[model samples]
Target: MSSPVAMIPYTNMAPYRQLGAPRDCRFVPVVPRVSIGALLSGEVVAAAVPVGGLKALEGVVETVGRFGIAAEGECMSVLFFSCVPFEEMHFPRTIRVTGESASSVRLLYLLLGSIHGFNRLPHIAADGRVFDGELLIGDRALVKGQATAGEERHFITDLSQKWFDIHRLPFVFARWVVRKDAPGPIKSAISDWLDEFKAREASLVEQAVPEAARTLNLPPAAIRRYFQVIRRSLGERDVLGQQLFIRQFEERGRSLLFQPAP
Candidate 1:
C-alpha cells in the first residue's frame, strides 16, 4: 500500500520539518489552494488548509488535531499595503488581492465589509500596477514590509492585527485537517506529530529562524518576532475567536461556512 500523504505549506513548513517528517508518511509541500485540491482528490490524506476554503470541506474533512496557524495581534505575513490610510479610503477603491492564500483574501473582505463597513465592497484590481491597495501574504508580504517606493511609503495594515483590534481574539488562518474516512493509524500518527511539535515548539522555531530569515531576506530578530505572533495551538480562546469571526462573517450575508466535521 502507498504511504499516506500529508500536505504542508511550502514557505511555512520549516517548523514542521524541524519536528522531523513523519517516517511512515510522505510530505507534500504546496500552497493552501493546492493543498485543498489534493485533499479533495484524496491525493493527500491530510493537509493544513486555509480557513476560507474550509467552508467547502465542511462534511468532507475532519480536524486532525488542534494544530493550526493563528495570530494573536500581528501576523507579519498577511498585510494590506495601501497608498492612503484605510480609514480615509472610500468605496470602489481598487485593491489587488494576492494570488497566494484564499483565507487571507476572504479575511480581507470580511474585515473591510463587516468591521470597516464598506457595504459596496472595493473593486478587486486585476493589475497590481493600477491598484490603490494590495493584499499580500506569506514571504512576499514579509519582504515587502511597508511596500515603499523611493520616498513614498504605503499605509500598512496587518490583517491579524486589525482582527484583534476589533475582536480582541486570535485570528486563525489555517488548520490541520484529514479526510473523514482516513485510517485510524494515520489520524493517530498526525495527533502524535502535533503533540511532539507542541512539546518542542520553541526549539523548532529557533531552528527554523535562520532559514526563514534567509528565505524571506529578513533579519533573524525580525523573523523571531514574526514567529512570536503566530499561535500554534487551538486552545479555548482561539476557538472562541474563530467562532466569533464566523458569526460576524455570516452576519454579513455570507453563506454558512466551516463546521468542523466529526
Candidate 2:
C-alpha cells in the first residue's frame, strides 16, 4: 500500500486546496515557489513556483508574460519590508534575511529597488547578520516576530500595502506553473486542487498553528478575518491587480532588464 501523504499548506496555497481531493492522489506539504526552478529544469514533474525560478531554468521558458500570482490591491500577507528611519538605517548596512523564504528574498529586492527607489543592499544569510532589523517571512514571521518586534528598533513596511498605496493594485509575487511540455492531466489536477483549496479554507484554518495568533498579536477571530482577506484578494479577477503586477514588472524590465519579480 502507498503511504498516506500529508498535504502541507503554503502561504499562497489555499486556493489550490479549495479545489478538492485528487482522484487517486494525496497531496504533501511542498512549500511555495521553491520548486519552480527545479520543475522547469525538468528536475520535478510540477510545482507552485516563482517566476524567478522559471528564469533560472536554463532557457526553458521563452516568454513569461501569460501567467503569475498577481492580485488587485492589498494582498495583506505577502511582500513585507522593515526598516529604521532613513537617518537610522545605516546606509550600506548588510541586510539579514529569514533563511526559510526562497521567494521573498528576490521579491523584497525587486520591490525595494523598483518601487521604493532603494539601490545597492547586499544579501546576507540570517545567521550572519547581527543586526536586529531584518526581513522575515513564512513560519518565521509568526514564530520569531514578537521576540523581535519593536525591540529590533526599526520601522516596518508591508510591501503589499506599499505597492497598493503606490499603484492601487495587488502584487503578484509568484505563480502556479508547469513545464510547457508537462502532461495536461497533471495541470488539470493541480488546477482542480487549487479551486478546492480556496473553497475550503475554513477547514484548513482550524489546523493552523494557534501560536500564529499569539505571535501576530491577533485574536482567533482576527486571524480568521485575515484569512478571509487573503481569500477575497486572491479570488478576485480584478484588473487593477493584474495591471499593478504587469506595470511594475514591465517598468523594471525596461529600466533594469529584470525578468520578473517572482
Top model by TM-score, which number? Answer: 1
Query: TM-score for each prediction?
Result: 0.89, 0.65
- Native-vs-model 2 lDDT? 0.48
Per-residue accuracy of model 1 over 40-123 as CA lDDT, tens digit each: 888888888887678778888998667798989988888888888877544656777766686787788777776447455666
Question: Among these predicted structures, which one has the highest lDDT?
Answer: 1
Candidate 1, run of 10 with poorest lDDT:
253-262
Residues 62-153, candidate 2, lDDT per residue (tens digit)?
A: 32223445444444445343456422333344456544444455555655565335443433424434552466555445334434446554
* Window of ten residues with lowest summed lDDT in model 2: 253-262
Candidate 2 wrongly placed segments (more than 4 Å): 1-21, 41-43, 56-83, 86-90, 99-103, 114-129, 143-154, 198-219, 232-262
User: Backbone collision count in every prediction?
Assistant: 0, 21
Question: How many clashing pairs in candidate 2?
Answer: 21
